[model samples]
Structure formats: structure tokens, C-alpha cells
Target: MHSKIFRGIQQEDVQVAADALIAEGLRPTIERVRQKIGRGSPNTVSPMLDNWFAGLSKRLGVANASDEQRLQPPEPVQAAAAMLWQAAMQLAKHAAQEEFLQENQKLDMRRAELQNHEAELISRQEAFNARQIALDETLQLARDQLTAMTSRLEEAGILQARRDREIEELRQQLKSREDERDAELQRRNDDATRHADERLRLEARATANEHRWLTELDRERLEVKRVVSAHIELESRAQATQTQLKTAQAALLDRLNQAERSLKDEHHAHELAKMHILELQSSLDVCRLAYAEIIKSQASQEPKNSRRKPLKQLMRGVTVRRKL
Candidate 1:
């Protein structure tokens, strides 16, 4: 029942419809055919195919010169020629669709590869930023340590100065005591020798105490000097460390700047590539439109009967050559 209904349209008419669709840049696959005729399923396409064959068979049967000529060319020849033209056009559309599909696949693959490259660049940039942050923290820590060492060194110097002042005052007090003791001895010359001996002994004891205090002060000063020297050495080391840190930071900054520049270049390249892809897509669309227009123009220009004879002859020759 379905075949009978679809057979009513005839193959030649189906071929013409297919040619028209192809000329309009529409592909004529089974699904497309079903959609074009507002039907559903592969069953619909099968009937359409049967109808197409029936129409082509009738046109081929009537191609031999016989009966009355309705148009400039005989009806049968024109119909057969139109059917062949439609078939040829459909074949062309199929080839174009296949080529277009392959091109789209290639474009999709290239886009994926570019996206992956962009992702890797982003990851590298993130890692560089992390390293820069770490370097900055390290530099800050080194600076803080250097500053603390400087403050400690200053405190040590102040303490050493105070110790020197105390030592000087003690020396002056000892000198005055010795002068007083000598004056007392000169004044006591008419007195007893025992008192003079006792006075000398006391003065010697005072001198010994002064000498001991002076030695102790010298030792304290030496100890302070050692500490100050050690502190100065530490300060010098801190300064060296600070200098090294600064140099390292500078180098890191340079590297970061270089990376930033590289990233900028990459971004620019990606943008350019994106633009190029867009232009290519636009060109492809234009080419497709031009192709469709060309097909339509050719279809309009060529006579229905004249277009198919060469191709039919070629096909017949191929068959004949195969048989030979």
C-alpha cells in the first residue's frame, strides 16, 4: 500500500526534486529526503527511492525517438535528461557534503589542540606567579632579619660606650685617692714611722684595689668589644644576605617580566589565530554560498535535455567498455 502511493510520484519527478534541493545547498540523504517531503522514517525514503527509479525507468524507456515531440526536444528525451541531470547534481552535493564534513572534523581537532595549548600556558603562568610570591616572602623575611641584626648592633655599641665612660670615671677617682694619700704622707713626716708604715700599707691596699678594679674594667671592656665585634660581624653577614636577597629578587622580577611578556605574546598569537579561524569560517561560508549560487546558475543556464546526454553517453561507454 505504501509503495503504491509513493510510486504515483514517479522517479523522474523525485530526481528533479532532489536536484533542486541539492542546487539549494541541501543534502539529499534519506533523512533529508524524509524531512523535505514532510514525512518520517527510512520507510518513507525507501518509497521515495522506488518512485525515483520508476520515473527514471519511464524516462529512459521513452528516450528513443518515437511518438509526438511536446517541447523543443522530445518529452521522453527531456525527461530522461532531466532525471540524469538531477542524479548528477545529487552526486555532486554528496561529494561536497563529504568534503565539508572532513574539513569540519579537521577544524574541530585543531581547535581542541589550541585549547589544550592555551590551558598549558595558563598553568605555567600560575606556577610562575606562585614562585614569585614565594620569592617575595623570602625576601621580606631576610629584610626583617637584617633590620633586627642592625638594631642589636646599635644597642651593643651604646652599651660598650657606657662601659668605657664608667671605666674612665673610676680611673679619675683612683688618681685623686693616690694624690690625697701622698699629700697625707708628706704632712706626717714629723710623726712616728709606724704610723707612716701603716699609712703606706693602706695606700698600697687602695692602689691594689684600684689596679684590680682597672683590670676588671679592662676585662669588661674587652668582653664588650668582643660582643660588639661579633655583632658587627653578624650585621655584616645580614647586610650581605640582604644584598643577595635583593639580587635574587631582582632576577626573579626580571624572569617574571620576561614570562609576562611571553604570555602577552602568546595571548596575542591566540587572538590572531582566533581571528584567522573566524575569517576562514567566514570565507568557507562565502565559498559555500558561492558554490550553491553557481549550482543554481548552472541549473538555470543549461537546457534540461542538453545537460544529461554527455554524462549518459559517458556512463554507457563505461558499461560497454566493462563488458568488452
Candidate 2:
């Protein structure tokens, strides 16, 4: 099938077909040659048929040169040859006229087909142009949309970056504030602890002083009682010896005056000890009040769990001292 589709008439094929037509006493025109072969276009068959005819004339001339050595024709044979030549000429002219008419009809049909093909091509070209214009418009619109989307994406990226930076700054500020707060709380705790320790030491010293003063006051009271007893006994002895011994009585009266003066000195010393005890008690009260105020001030500044046990114990000591 592939060979048949691609096969075309060659010059040899045209020559063979024309020779066969001549053997059958037929003119080998383009149509007749194509009909003989059953296939081939006129444009291909025409030139090949003409080439066969030119070669046939040359072969006939060669055959006639050999015939010239045989004989000259008689008058009657010449007259018959002339008539046969005219008839052959008329037959060739009629065949050529028919071939010309057939070629003209084919050319007219081909021209009409070509005109129809040209009209179809024009319509197709116009449609193609319109489609191209539409495609260009679509491409331009797509490019514009892409540009707008790109700009929007860039702006969004910039905004996101700015927000990230702001968030980072805020986090840094919050961290600094937290650090400062922690440091301040630590300092206050250390100060409260130091003040509590100092107050405890002061209370302990004041308590020791108070105990010593109390012990001294008790010893002075015992001395005052002993002196009064001694004076009463000497008075009784002087009354019993009043009329019996006059010189001895003068010595006894002088001794009685010395005893009274000794009693007055003891009373004065007792009063001074009482006054010293009062001053020590007042000083303790002042110390207690000042310590209470310090504790109150510390409580205002410190947490609820700050060292309060020492202050309570100090207040208790003050209350006990007031009672004493």
C-alpha cells in the first residue's frame, strides 16, 4: 500500500503507453496516455508523451533511409500516398482539437477549485488574526494581575517584619522591668533582716541592765532596815542607865547623836538609789517606745512574713518591766 500511494508515472512508463497506443492506431495524446496507464496527471504525461513522439520520428527517418535503396514509387502509388497523407493529417487535426477542448475544460475546473481554496484561506487568515488579538489581550491582563499581586505580597512582608521587630522590643522592655523589680525586692529583704538582728541585740542589752538595777535596789532596802534596828537598840540601853552613872551617861548621849546622824545618811542614800532606779526605768520605756516605732515602720514596708517574733518578744519584756 505504501508503494502504491507514492508511485508516479516515469518517462519510461509514458513511452511504453504511447508506443502501445500507436500499435493500436490511436493518437497518444495526454488524455489517451493517462487513460492507457489508468493513472497520471496531464502535466506529467504531456512532456513525456511529446518526448516519445520526437524519438519515434527519428526512428522512422532511420527506417526510411534504408527504404530509399529499395525503389521509387509509381504515379498511382504516389497519388494514393498523397490522399492517405491528407486523411492522416485530418485525423491528427481532429484528435488535437478534441485533446485541446479536454485540456481547456480541465484548466477551467482547476481554476474554479483554486478560487474556492483562496476564499477558504482568506476566511481562515481573518479568524487566525482575531484569535491572536484576543490571546494578546488575555496575556496582558494576566501580566497586570501578576504585578498587582507581587506588590501586595511585598507590602505584606514589610508589615510582618515591622510587627516582629515591635514585638521583640516589647519583650526586651518587659524583661528589664522584671529584673529591676527582682533586685529591689532582694535589697529590701536584706535590709529588713539586718534591722531585725540589730533590734534583737539592743533588747538583749537593755534587759541585762534592767536586771542589774533591780538587784542593786533590793540590796539598798536591806541596808536601810538594818540601820533602823541598830538605832532602836541603842535608845533602849541609854534609858535603862539614866540615874545610876552620870559620866558614863554623857558618853552614851554622844554616841546616840552619832547613831542618829548615821541613820540620816542611810535615808539620803536610800532616796538617791530610788531616784536612780526611776531614771533607769524611764530610759527603758523610751527605748521600748522607739523600738516599737521602728518595728511599726518596718512592718509597713515589709511583707506579712517578715521577722515579727523578735518584736513580740520585746513588747512582752517591756510589759513585764512596767509591772515590775
Candidate 3:
């Protein structure tokens, strides 16, 4: 980015050119300065022109210039030039102070904007954190509910097992009762056979003792009635046991149905919780994407904004430099 340079333009060259322009009764504008010096940026030459004009005005006994000079003061003009230089320095300092203040004001505005952006970002982050925590709590609650449902299912399984064992025990007791009834029936049959044989023997042997035979027959009849009564009682007990078994089976079936219903309900609740979680996750994703886009956009714009025009001019040497 180097530009063509003008050779041989020294410190005295600017003053000599300005004096010649003044002799021609023309204002020593930068255009006049560059036309005489033949090379320099507007930034380099303009301040030199301001100094030349300000010095000329001071030689005529005026004061103040907002610029510096390359022209050396002659011995005759030294005291007046020094006063003029001081006034010019003061004017330049005031102008620089004004520019600095203005720049600071701009910087303050930019900082305030950045601060506002930061506050907004913090608010959004806090909202995100709160929402995430809420989701976590909800998920935890769902997990707890699922755990409870599983525990209940285990309890139901144990209850079903207990019912099966109870039913098995009742069946064993009913079988034992039936076996006892069968044994009693066999005993009654044998007693009937013995009584029949005794009556027949008595009939065959005793034509004398009719009163004793009649008494033995009446005793056999009473014995038969007692066996029948015991059979009836056993049958009643078996019927009662069957009723209890049926009731227990029905109750067990009801319990199974109730457990099934509860499991279904729990499953439905679990499904709803999952759906809610999914919805929250979707919302969170959307929010994250939006925030990411905002940050990306902000990042993209910042560098463009940071590349200031004054800085660019300085880099390109469009402006002059202080010698120090």
C-alpha cells in the first residue's frame, strides 16, 4: 500500500512556499501548501497550512492556532513566535481535549449498549436455568411415581402369590374333609351289613324270644338313623367349604382386575409425564437455538462495528503523525 513519495520537501520548504503564497497575497490553504510542497496527505499539509496562516496572523500581532508548525522562528521574530506558539499549543490542546471528550462520550454509549446486552443475556440465562430446574424436578417426580407404581406392582404380585397359596391350602383341607366323609360312609356300610346278618341269624334261630328280636331291630333302625344324620352333616360341611372356595376365587379375581386397572392407570400417567417432558425439551431446544442465533448475530456484527474509520485512515497513512 505504498504511495509515490515527493522528494526534497524539508522544514524550510513549507515556510518558503507559504511565504511565497503570502507574497502573492493568497491564503495558504493545504491545496496551496500541496501545490508548493508537491507531496503530502491533506492531513499532513492542512495543519501546516493552519500554522503558516496562524503565524502570519501573529506576525501581524494576532494570537492562537489549533495546529503546530515545521517553520523555524527567526531571531527577530523569536519572542513574538514563542507567544504565538504557546497560544497555538493551547488552542491545539483545547481542540484535542474536545475530541477526546467526544470520543469518550461515544465509548460510554457503546459500553452502555454492551451492558444492556449483557443484562438481557443474563436475564435469559436465569430464565433458562429456572426452566431447566423445573423440568428436572418434574422428571424426578415422574421417576418417583414410576418407582411407586413398580412397588405397587410388586406388592400386587406378592398378594396374588398369597392368594394362590391360600386357595391351595383350602383345596387340601377340602380333600381331607372328603376323605373323612368317604371313610365314615364305608364304616356305615359295614355296620349295616353286620346288622343285616345279625337279624337274619336271629330270625332263623329264635321262634321263642320275639320280644328280644323286636328290641334288636329297633336298635339297628336307630343306629342307621344316626349314620344318615352324620352323612347329612358331612355333606353340609362340604357345601359350605365349596361356597367359601368360590367366594375366595371371586375375591382373588376381583383383586387381579383391580391390580390390572391400577397398572393401566399408572401406565397412562407415565405416558402423560413422558409427553410433558418431551414438550418441555422441545421448548428448551427452541429457546437454545434462538439464543444461539442471537449470540451468533451479535458476534458477527461486533467486528464490523469495531473497525473504526479514523483507525483505518491512520493505518493507511492518510493522516499525519506527531514527531515525538
Candidate 4:
């Protein structure tokens, strides 16, 4: 029922307000129509007022006919009525002109607001395009760096694999050398043992031969004393006894020379045995030095824990050689 309760004034409401103003004997200008309706803008009221004015002549003709049949008006009253009608028409025209100017000003303001909004949208679109280009370039750089890193990682892997293979080959070679050294050490130890036993046997043999030569020399000295006593008692046959003593003395001297030669030969044989023992000892020492060198090389190449067994074996071999 109230115009204020609605979002905007309707055409029917405007018409009603204009008709009411006419009834009150007032010109239906935009402001007068709004004042009657209680709410409406000039832009909305102007068109409605024009429609009402267009039909006003027909309504006036019908009213005038009815009034003539009822009673004729006096002449002065008719003239005043005609003059009021002309004044109302002129006021309506002026109101319409003012409303048209106000509408034109509002239209110009709306067009400017729309143009500003369009410019803001275009600026935002350009900024978005620039940001997208930067993002794409950054992504490409990251991909290139990733590819280079992957290539380096692959190369490092290949180099590591090659080093591992070479280390394995070195280990195999060291193992073979150790085996050969162990066998040679065993052979040398056996030779040393044999030589030691032979030396002991030769020493025992030399001692027995020396004892036998001393006993033979003592018997020859006793025989020479007995022969001298017999020669002194038998002087009546001095010539034959003297001849026999000379022959016995010559045989004793020959036996002494033979025993001396035998002793010298035994001493020479004992010296040869000692020289052999010395040679065997020297050989064992060489073997020990070579084994130590092998151990040193292995220790440097291998882990400490892995070297323990080989070191123990070398120690055992040295102990055996010492005993020999």
C-alpha cells in the first residue's frame, strides 16, 4: 500500500498520483505527483505523467457533456475554467523538460563508471600474463639442473663399480702369492730340520773316531817302551835286535802319520757339516724376511681384522724356523 515498502515506484502508482493531483485542481507536475504518492523519482514519474495527460482531453469532454445536461455554468466561471486548463498544460510541459535534463546527466555518469571498470580488467589481465611467463622459465631451469645432477650421479656410480672390481682382482693375486710363500716356507723348514739332524749324527760319529784314534796311539807308545827294554837285555845278539828295533820304529812312525791324517779328515768332515748348517740357517733367514715383506704388503692393503690369521701363521713359521 505504501510506495516506500517496494524497491521502486510502479507505473500504476504514478498514474494514480497524477489523477489525484488533477482532482485536487492542481497541475500534475513530477514533484506534485511524487508528493501525492509519498515516494517516486522524477525519471520514473515523468513517463507516467505523460500517459495520463494524453488521455486527459477525452475525460474532460465526457465531464463537460454531463455537466451541461445537469445545469449550464455562468459565463465568467467558464472563462476561468478555460484559463486554468491552459496554465496546467504549460506547468506539465516545464516539469517534463526538467526531468529529461536530470535523466541525461545520470546516463553520462553511468557510461564513465563502465569505462573505468573495463580499464581495470585489462591491466589485471596483462599482469597475470607476465607472471605466467616467469613461472614457465623458472620451471625449465629447475628441469635442466635436475638433469645435470642425474648425469653426475650415474657417472659416480660407474666409477665406484670399476674401483670395486680392481680391488677384488688385487685380493685374488695376494691370496695366490701367500699360498706359494707358505709352500716354500714349508720346504725350507723341512730342509733345515734334515740338516740339523745330520749335523748331530756327524758330531757323534766324529767323537767315536777321536776316542778310537787316542786308544790306538796309547797302545803304540806302550809297545815302543817294551821294545827298548828287550833290546837292552839282549846285547849278545845286538846286530839282529838293532835291525828289528829300526823296523819297528819305522812302522810306529808310519802308524802315527796315518792316525793324524785320519783325524784331519774327520775334522774336515765336521767343518763341512757346520758349513752346511750355516747355509741352511741363512736360507731360513731369507725365507723369514720374504714372509715379513709379504705380511707388510697384506697389512697395508687389507683391514686390520682380516690380517690377523696371516700374521699368526707367519709367527708360527718363524717359531718353527728358530727351533730348527
Candidate 5:
């Protein structure tokens, strides 16, 4: 294949250039020839120029090398050489013209292929741009959704915090109530113990009184025959003492029953309070579990920073929306 760059140059163009250079006292060297022709290959131009020079040398008695001996040709050979030179010039020009046309055809085909490639690239770029825009829209929508979910999570957290605070207060109250109940139970026990001691003291006093009455009765029996009036008075005093002992026993029994009932009621109250406290603790545990699940769900939905809307921002949003 010919050089794509220098294919447009013709043989006649090279000859004309060589002749002009010769007139200017410059030898048609390869570099000069290429400069004169504007553009041509050494391979294509060198052979054509060599043939033209050989034909000329055949026409004249001249040596191509400055040191070489010259030889003369016959007039018939000279005339034939001149004719051959003309024919060779015509053939060289024709070949160059055909090659130039072929090169141009190839160039046109290359340009068309490049244009088709450019069009395909442009379509692909447009499709990529559309896809990028779609991706951007989807990303923005996801961000908005994340923000909304974050706000909801924050609100849930706030409610949970309030609930926790309330539960803590209730726990404190329950603790205080338990302390009071324990103190009251201690006081009731002290009272029951005090009453038991008092009952024992009363029983001891009644027994002593019975022993004294028995001793006095034995003495009165011994004196009954000697003093009836004195014996009757002593007997009446013994009956009054017996009645007081029965009254004291009845009062002691009533006090014991009342204390036992009070103890039962207090125990029942303590058991009910314990049940309520246990229920509160159970509900608190459930609330904690539910809150943990919500947090886990939010974390799974998005990245930490992506889903987290700050509390201040959330509050601001709520205020703004309310104002609007």
C-alpha cells in the first residue's frame, strides 16, 4: 500500500519540482524533492526520479557519478530513450493518480466509519445520562424516606423516654410504699408483742388474786362457825373479784382477735402491692423489648448517619409544620 499521507503528490509534480530546483542551482536531493513536491514518499518518488534520470543519461553522453567515466549511445538509442522517458512519465503519472484516488476512497470509508462510531458513542452517552438522572432521583427519594423514618424513630424514642421516666417514678413510689408497709408491719408486731405481755401480766394478777381468795376462804371456813357475819362479807368480796377477772379475760380476748384481724389485713395489703409492683416491672420489660426492636428495625433499614435525624432538627420540623 502507498503512504496514506504522500499519496496525493503526482510524478509530473515531482519533475516540475526537480526542474525548478535545478534552475535554482540546487540538486534534487530526497529532502529537497520532498520539500519541493510539498509531500511524497521516498519509496514512490525515488524510483520514478531514478528512471527519469537514467532515461536522460541514456539520451546524453554523461556519467551519473561525478568520478565515473562517461559512455555515448547511438542516435537511434538516444531517440528511443527519449521516447521511453516520455512513456515512463505518462505511466508513472497514471499510476500515481489511480493510487491517489484509491487512497481518497479509503479515507472516505474511514471517515464514515468514524462518524458512525461517534453517533453510537453519543447514543450511549445519552442513555448513560438518563440512567444517571434516574439514579439521582431514586437516591433523593431514598434520602427523604430515610429522613421521615428517622423522625418517626426519634418520636418513638421520646415517647419511650417519657414512659421510662414515668415507670421510674412509679418504681420510686412503690419502693416508698413498701418501706412504709414494712414499718407499719413492724409497729403492728411490736403492738402485738406488747399486748401479749400485758395479757400475761393480767393472767398472773388474776392467778395471784385466786390464790389469795383461796387462802382467805380457808381462813373464813375455819372462822365461819365462830363469825358468820365476817364470813359472809369475805364471800361477797370473792364474788366481786371473780366477776372482774371474767370481764378482764373478755376484754383481752377481744383485743387479741382485733390484733389478728389487723395483721391479716396488713398482710393482704402487702401481697397486693407486691403483685402490682411485679406487673409494673413486667410491663416495663415489654416496653424495653419493643423499643429495642424498633431501634434494630431502623438500623437495618439504612446506614447510621443516613437514617438519623437529629432531635433538634426533628423538633424544628415539627414546629415548622405546626406553624404552617
Candidate 6:
């Protein structure tokens, strides 16, 4: 991995080269050696660098105290070391500046990505709000329509109930009228039957009176014949029987006239009774017909029940008037 990052040589190979160089008494900084030969195995290269630095410091008679110590040398060695240090410092400065620039570029890319994400978030939020508004409007419309339908359904139920009540009331009224008609008819039937029975009794009584009058007439005729035969015997015997015969004839005529008068009176009473019976029968028939007519009229009127068509038309006219 280190070889790929630095290129051309493996980390182990770099470590071996750095170690060999250090063993020949070369002193190098880890960063400088990394630039030259790349980062090597720490176990091999790190100790070599530390040892070389210690040996070089001793050879140059550097102080043991920790400070920003410089290498002091013979005049010729001092000039060479100063030049090398100057070059190494310049290279390290250039590498640090390059790393700083790369870091700044990375920060700029991250800022651009964050700005784009914020803009996308704002767009998504606006779209979500618009969709929410649309959904609320749609729900409100649905609720309004549902409320209107429910009101219409309730009104329809009320109207149906009213219609049912009206129909039931009409049926009850018709039943009451029918019961009244039936009662009237029964009364008329009873009266008619009574009249017929009375007429029959009167006719039978008239027939019995006629039979008794015929029997009386036959007995009176036989008595008159007997009295005439006795009167003839008395006349032949003596002239003095003439007055008794005249008296007997007058009594027989009187009795016959009385029976005729009684029969005529009975016949007149029977005629009067028959006339009364006929009058009663006529009255009963007229009453029955009137009752039947009443029933028919009531039945016909029951269906109208105040005439809904006219009422509806009137209501419509009123509404139109109000609108106008």
C-alpha cells in the first residue's frame, strides 16, 4: 500500500536502503528520507535514523541539552551541512504548502455539496407543502358532498314517512265508513222483515173473518125457510097468525144487514193495514239506497286526501314568486 502511495519501491525495500545508508554514518530526518526513498518499515528505519542523529551529533560535538541545535563543523564541513539543510527546508516548505492547498480544495467541494443538498431540501419541502394543500382541499370537497347527500337522504326518509302516515289514515277512515254503512244496512233489513211479518198477520186475520161471515149467512138462510113453512100452516088454520109472520120477517132482514156491515168494516181495516205496510217498505228501500250512495261517495273521496298535485303546484308557484 505504501509502495502504491509513494510509487516505484516497496516499503520494505525503502527501509533496507535507509538502514544501509544510516549504517554508513549518514544522518537524515524521517520526512526528508520519506521524500527521497518513501515511508519504509518503522521497525527498521526509525531506529536507524535515531542512531545516526545521535552519532552525528556526537561527532560534531553538539550539546546534550535539548534546544534548536545546529550542526557545528570544521569550516568546510559547516558550509556543506548548511547548504544541505537549506535545500531540505525549502523542499519541506513546498510539500506543506501543497498539502494545505489540497485540504482547501477538499473543503470547497464539501461546501458546494452542502449547498446543493440544502437547495434540494428546500425544493422537496415546497413540493410536500403544495401536495398537502391539495389534499386538504380535496378532503374538504368530499366532506361537503357527503354532508349534502346525507341531508338529502334524511329529507327523503321524512317524506316517505309522511306519505306512509297519510296512506294509513286514509285506510282507517275508509274502514270506519264501511262499518257505518253495514250498520245502516242491518237496520233497514230488520225494519223490512218486521213490515213483511205484520202484513202477513193482517192478511190471515182478514181471511178468517171472511170465512166466519159465510157460515153465518148459510145459517140465517135455513132459519128463514123454516119460519116461512110454519107461517103457511098458521094461515090455513086461522086468519089471526098474520101479525107474527110479519114480525119474524123483519128480524131476519135486520140480522142479515148487521152481518154485512161487520164484514165491510173488517175489509176496510185490512186495506188500511196493507197500505201502512206498503208505505213502511217504501221508506226502508229509500233509506238503504241512500246508505249505499253514501258508502260509494266516501270510498271515492278517500283516495284524494287533500290533493297532493295541487299542493305541489302551489308550492312551486310560491317558490317561483319568492325567487322573482
Task: Highest TM-score: give the candidate number.
Answer: 1
As a TM-score, model 5 comes out at 0.33
Q: Candidate 5, residues 21-45: lDDT per residue as tens digits?
A: 8789976654577777777765567
Ranking by TM-score: 1, 6, 3, 5, 4, 2
Enumerate clash totals for all models, in the order shown: 4, 0, 0, 0, 0, 0
Root-mean-square deviation per candidate:
10.3, 64.1, 18.2, 54.3, 38.7, 53.8
lDDT, residue 63, model 1: 50
Expressed as tens digits, the lDDT of each residue in 1-324 for candidate 1 is 455544343444456666667778964554455555665544334446545644553566765333333335767877886677666545544554555566567666756766675676566667656765665666566566656655665666676567656656665665676566566655555443546667665777757866876686677657656755665676666567656656765665566566557656665765675676567567656656755664454334222233435886645543442332
Ranking by lDDT: 1, 2, 5, 4, 3, 6
TM-score of each: 0.43, 0.32, 0.34, 0.32, 0.33, 0.35
Tens digit of lDDT per residue, candidate 4, span 171-205? 56555655665675576467557788675666676
Give candidate 6 misplaced runs (Cα > 4 Å).
1-79, 194-324
RMSD of 6: 53.8
Candidate 3 lDDT, tens digit per residue, 226-316? 6556556655655565565556556555655665565566556555655655665565566556545533442232111222233434333
Clashes of 4: 0
The Cα error of candidate 2 at residue 55, in Å, is: 38
Pairs of residues at least 3 apart in sequence or in different chains that clash in candidate 6: none
Model 6 lDDT at residue 67:
50
List candidate 4 stretches off by more than 4 Å: 1-94, 190-324
Once fitted onto the true fold, the runs of candidate 2 whose alpha carbons sit more than 4 angstroms away are 1-94, 194-324
Q: Choose 3 or 4, whichever is better by TM-score.
A: 3
Pairwise TM-score winner, candidates 1 and 4: 1
Predict model 6's lDDT versus the native: 0.51
Better of 2 and 5 by TM-score: 5
lDDT score at residue 315, model 1, on the 0-100 scale: 55
